[model samples]
Each structure stands twice: as structure tokens, then as C-alpha cells.
Target: MRTLVVYESMFGNTAAVAAAIARALGSTDAVRLELADDRPAIGDAELVIVGSPTHGFALPSRLSRRAARAQGADASATARAGVREWLGGLAAVRADSAPFAATFDVRQAPGAVGAPSHRVRRRLDGLGFRTIGEPASFRVGPTAGPLLDGELDRAAAWAEGLRGLAR
Candidate 1:
């Protein structure tokens, strides 16, 4: 199955996780990994996975969106939109089809204040997508991490589990 993995990465941690998940699904040829900044078309994909970094009790909080825009001010149009904006627009663009969806987020180790993936999952559900399973979270060693050891492998395993749903 073709899969689309879209992610927002402030410091590349989430991007790495997204890459690992895509790799887990299959070769790069089978998976399309995109940064939220890319505004990738979700067309013709059997599975769609979205991910972002947890911020201020939510996924891509307003403050983070501002920060991302500010940091990427000179970047592409989509880069300034961030995951929140991409997701806000997703329902409309994907209205024609419902794909198996999943979400992931990078956060402080267990006991963090929020799980961005949960919020993403809720939004995806509200948009009428059939969620494959519980949203997943990968831990970061620090705010700008180097994911906590083994998180990539864990992410890959999570992606592998999605195979049952993808099929």
C-alpha cells in the first residue's frame, strides 16, 4: 500500500521519526515522507500518518505556530503554515476519501503535560477518517532532542503494526 507520512519538525526530531516510520512501512519508493511545510497531496495513498511536536498542552499550539512561522519566515509558503494549519485544511482537501489514519508526536518522557498525538487523533476522527489504532508518542531526551534512546525502533515497530490496518 502507498503511504503518506506528513510531519512538523522544529529541530528535526519528529522528521527523523517520520522517516523511520516511512522506512518501516517499506522502501522510500513505497512511502512518501513530507514535511508539513510541503503541503503534500494525500492523493492515492492507502494510509496517512500525521505527526508533530507537543507544545503548550497541545499539538502545534498557537505560540509554536508563530515560532515556526517566524523561524521559517523566508521559507516556502507551506513551511510557514505548520502542522496545525495543514491539518485544519486537511478535512476539506481529503473530503473525497477516507483513508486509514494515524498520528504520532514527540514529547517529553512519560508524564509530560500533553500528548499532541491525542489532539491530532481527535481532529482526524472529527474529519471522518478511520483511525487505525491509538495515536502514538515518541519521547525526546530534551526539548530539542535526540529522541530518547530506542524511540526510533519503537516508532518503526509502531509503523509495522499498522500493516494489519494498511492491508
Candidate 2:
């Protein structure tokens, strides 16, 4: 089945996690990977996966937005928009064609803080999509971080497990 992987990344950690998930699903050529900037066309995709980096305990926290603006008014290219905004604007899916949905996020370990993935899942659920597993999280090393070692492989495994559950 066709799948769409959408993500928002500040330091590329979330983007890497999204890529790993797309790869686990199948050939990169077959899966559509999108950054949150553009409104993604879900088309006939049977599965939809979304991701973002956790900022200030939420999806694109206020502080992150302020920081991005501080980077530059032209920081749109690097910071762009975030997944929360993208997901918030999604048109409601019809009941018949609503795809199986899932979400993931990248963040620091000891994950007590809230995550973007949970909010993504809730948004998908409210849009009438059926979710097939718990949201996933991949760890980053620091605030603007390279992901923790082996996290990509772990992400792949997590995606594989979710695929199994969906079947």
C-alpha cells in the first residue's frame, strides 16, 4: 500500500526518524516523504505517518517559534512551519477512505515531557482515522541534537512492529 510520511524538524533529528520509518515501510522510491511546509496530498495512500520534534513539552512550543523568529525573519527556509500547524489544518477525511494513522516524535530521554506524537495521533483520530498502535518516540542527544546512537535502527524496528500490528 502507498504511504505518506510527514515530518517537521528543527535540527534534522525528526526528519531522520521520518526517513527511517519510510524505509522500514518499503522502498524509498515508493513511499512519499514530506516536510510540514507544504500541505501534503494524501491521495490514495493507505497509511499515513506523521512526526515532529518535541519543543517546550509540546508540538512547536511557543519558545521554539520565538527562537526560530530570532534566528531570522527569513528563517522560513530552515524552520519553515511545524507539524502541529500542518496537522491542524488538515481537511477531515471521509469515513470510507480514512487511512490507518500513526505518529512519532524526537526528543530528549527520560521522556516525561509531553510529546508531539500524542497530539498528532489525537488529531488523526479526531479526523476519523483509525490508529493502529501507540505513538513512538526517538531520543535526541541535546536541544539541537543529533539523535542518540542506534535510534534510527530502533525507529525502523518500531515501524516494522507497527506494520505488523496493522496487518
Assess candidate 2 and give its lDDT: 0.79
Q: What are the per-model C-alpha RMSD values against the true structure?
A: 3.4, 2.6
Candidate 1: segments with Cα more than 4 A from true spot: 65-78, 92-97
Q: In candidate 1, what are the lDDT values of residues 54-137, reduced to their tens digit?
A: 777687755776675565522343245568888877753355567888999888768645788888888888887778877898
Q: For candidate 2, lDDT tens digit of each residue in 1-112?
A: 6788988776677878898888998843368998877878778878888988777778885468667457442354455566877876888889987888888888896564
Best by TM-score: 2
Please give each candidate's TM-score. 0.84, 0.88
Which stretches in model 2 have alpha-carbon errors above 4 Å? Answer: 61-63, 68-77
